[model samples]
Target: MNRFDTDLIIAGGGLAGATLALALARVVPSLRVTVVETFPLSADALPEHYQPSYDARSTALAWGSRLIFEELGLWPRLSEHATPIRQIHVSDRGHFGATRLNAGDHGQEALGYVADNRWMGLCLMRELLETGVQWQAPAEVVDMTPETEGVRVALKRGTETWSLSAQCLVVADGGRSGLREALGFQTRNHSYGQNALIANVSTGESHRFTAFERFTDAGPMALLPHGTTTRAGHQSALVWTLTDEALDEVLALSDPQKCQRLQERFGWRLGRFTRIGECSHYPLKLTTVDEAVRPGVALVGNAAHALHPVAGQGFNLALRGLMTLVEQLRQAVEQGQSLGDLQVLGRYQRLHRQDWQQTVQFSDSLIRIFGDAPAPVAAARDAGLVGLDLLPGAKRWFARKAMGLGGRRAVISKPGVARREPAGHE
Candidate 1:
């Protein structure tokens, strides 16, 4: 008889958790998997059709992410609502340093793509419903205890409580993960002392599938091409960084006044800002856990590391880590080793640690170099930008890093691996 209730139990079912579940279902169907989530999910709850909204939240998927999804057979549906980033424009406000990277110059169709968060969740949920993975929604892991060979978790659903054991437990709740704290994981946080104002705006001219990253003395701002153009005009998702005081002042202004302020800071690169939608803001911080793995347990996604949104590298990095974990787990199954073996999990961490460190440093450096640099440093930064634009090899290197192709790529698929029925539960 099987000793555990499930081979793997994943806490939380948001983007990161859901994506990991779907990836595992595709790569290792033989392993029994169960996902515990706070929010309820059902076929009846999902929308049959997706309608794009101006204020809808979105995520940027780097080019490498596209390859990962294609391997799982999800890109076909996801691309339906995705807007390709054909070019990227990086510049410093009030300075002549600016660089433009074209997808054609890099021998690719697009550097990345942006898709609505709701629509992406819809795609992931739909695919997950058809898989063999079990679901426990409107439920959560109240607490967990590590054992010799596995972990035991107490789950609470509505008024009822139950216990289950799993050989491996994956905590992917979110940035503010309660499970992570309950597990006693230590973390380091560096606050940027800035808040990001997010909204969707329409301009007088088309975006031409271009994304803009403009840095100012206050902070950095990004404009990603949103969905298709409407009679309202071209649209783009705005992520404007501001001090706490500035954010309050801007949020209190009328729409037209807000547009004027934005125009002053962003210039007429996309022509005049005609309309702005509802606005939301969140504080920016760099949060990282001391260790991502322990015997019989692991953390993925935001639970492991939360980065600044200006760089748009958080989700892409998480996707890479989860895929690497899946690869290592696949090897464990083939070698007849315990899924929760420290050696197995450590190898996964060791293989992915370099990418994790490099990405965090890259994102952090961008903010520090431009946030409040001295005059001499500012001039050097500007000169560096100009040199990056002028040199072909340097441009390629920068472009690859931005597109998430600089690190070691994870192997997400193997041909001729047939699906097998999961082991029986006690």
Candidate 2:
């Protein structure tokens, strides 16, 4: 028998990595776990914490993921910062066709909830403290080499170099995953020729927990309800995907000027856009990694795929990726199979084969279908939304897919984190 350094070593302490740590800690109390993070973020959060010029913007939580968080005991804490999405309205630019999806339609209070990235991170961090994960904060994982026995990880914390070995390694460092690259995982990327402008805007009237997706010639514009925390009256977070030229205008503008441009685009539907909070921008790109696991390594989150935010699936996929791995790893352990074995990893790939493949294709085609500037294509886009609204089954399926739980479980669940409940429990 070969000796292992740690039970699990996770790189990247973002949501996926951190949440996985907590889940593993809960399921396998004796499993040794460690998280390495690169961010030099402050330990404390500012009051109201609304500010312009921030890195992470906001994210939507799918129902399936919410359940996982609820199980992990992170939802109640998150509810304080989340705004439930009671309704979602969709429309195209300069068209009369529109559709609205309500909680009543789905027989649920809301389809999902939206939270500012910072607040969500804070909530996860709280859970981490309780999870008992050994943290190596402000530490970047420089190298991860798989040995015959397990994997070795090299880290750099400021000017110091440290090493750690683990039986299995999880690479969740995101799209440009350094560890994945070092291991030679292949990735394909497609750019959207646009940049997304994200910020919080105060629209005077109450948004009533409604989310809106407005398709424009530039790209889709989304306003996710983020209940007012500032004097901005009624506030919502804005996501405007723009053409390079339009993005240039936005990037060059002063804060006040950018807010003015947004006010003109969104109109007074909510109210005049006023107070702005935390402006961030990113050029849109779509990417996918065929093999999520290599040798003794496994990948999750953006490290495996980066989706278009127009559909809000990046973090949703992150949750899905980690959940799938957790369940699989648990099962493998019980089955007496090595968690890092190719057989175990292959099962995960197979289980996610349909859902993940569909996700990438869905996001890719979704953007292309709606983003074309042609007049007829624009008409088709509106027609599609109007059609989905009128068709009960289509609308319901769409909601299910968007919620990240089409249910459809595989014949065999993946290995590595098989959790069994008490008798009469699921």
Candidate 3:
């Protein structure tokens, strides 16, 4: 009989979980893997919006992340729905500080890309169906026991209960992961006293594939280009941050009133904010676990570190972490080492520490520097922006970080693997 039910059991079937599964399947074709998710994974089983990853919010995929997807052969499906960002415009509102980063300056085709979260989820779900990894949805890990050899998982699905064992368990659940908490993992929390208001908007002018990040005393607001609207005008995804009171006030406003407020804040750069689709709000906080790995378990994605949306670093960082983990896991498997051994997982942890620290610190710094309204801090931040614009080398460094470059990289695909370009790319 087999020593375990599967070689790896991933809890949470979101992007990180699914991507890890796909990567593992490619690296270790013989590796047995299973994904357990609480939300409906089947398209016909639930309303489209009801999918766990179906939030209206969009993800700004760093250029490096795009490469990872391409290496995994999932980029072709995602590229169709992605909107490329050729340039980024950073400015401090009501201040004389601004900077712009262009893809051409870095010899790249795009600075980054913006993709609808719902579309990404659907694409990932479709890929999961075609993969060799086992998929179980509307299911959850009710209990897990860590041992020297492996982790035993007790999953609950509807009225049925199943017991399984895995050499390693990966937790990719979101910020409020019950399984993570149940395992007694402690987290450090920093609430920003702010909320992000997100929505799709139609602007009077074309976006021209430019992304704008304007920092105000209230908070930082971003208008990410989402390609053209049905009316042939420009459309952008709005991510506006506000304090608690302002968030409440904005949420209570009518559509036209909200548009007017957005216009006042964003100015006439994109002309007028003519229309806005359904709006959603998410509380902003930075949460990080005390440790991301145990003897038989590891944490990935938000389960490891839930970052502020500032700079759009959360998901990109998670992808980097996932890649590192997979690389380390591959080493363990090749060396015939036990996957659940702390020594094996420890290597993975050590390799990922720098990347995690740098990303977390970078994200937190942006939130601290821009989310506050203190006079001295605001002035200093504005001057910093001015300095960044003046220094080409510094600007390139910042852009590279934003593009998810630097640091140690994991091998995503075979050295000479080629991929198909998605439709709509110029």
- Position 91, candidate 1: lDDT: 96
Give lDDT tens digits, candidate 1, residues 1-426.
999999999999989989989998998888899999999876765887778878899999998888888888899999988899989999999989999999999778889999999988899998998999999998999888888789898999889999999999999999899989999999899999999999999899889999999999889999999986222238999999999999999999999999999999999999999999999999999999878899999999999999998778999999989989998998898898878889999988888889889999999999988878889999999999999999999998888888888776677655475533211100
Q: Order of all candidates by lDDT, from best down to worst?
A: 1, 3, 2
- Across residues 73-122, which tens digit of lDDT does each residue of candidate 3 receive? 78997887788888899998888878899999988888889887777777
In the range 204-250, model 2's lDDT, one tens digit per residue, is 68888888888766678998887543222366778899988998888
Reference-based lDDT, each prediction: 0.89, 0.75, 0.82
Query: Which one wins on lDDT?
Result: 1
Where model 2 places Cα greater than 4 Å from the true spot, the runs are: 40-56, 228-233, 407-426
| Off by more than 4 A, model 1 | 229-233, 415-426
lDDT of 2: 0.75
Candidate No. with top TM-score: 1
Q: How well does model 1 score by local distance difference test?
A: 0.89
For every model shown, the clashing-pair count is 0, 14, 0
TM-score ranking from best to worst? Answer: 1, 3, 2
Task: Write down the TM-score for model 1.
Answer: 0.95
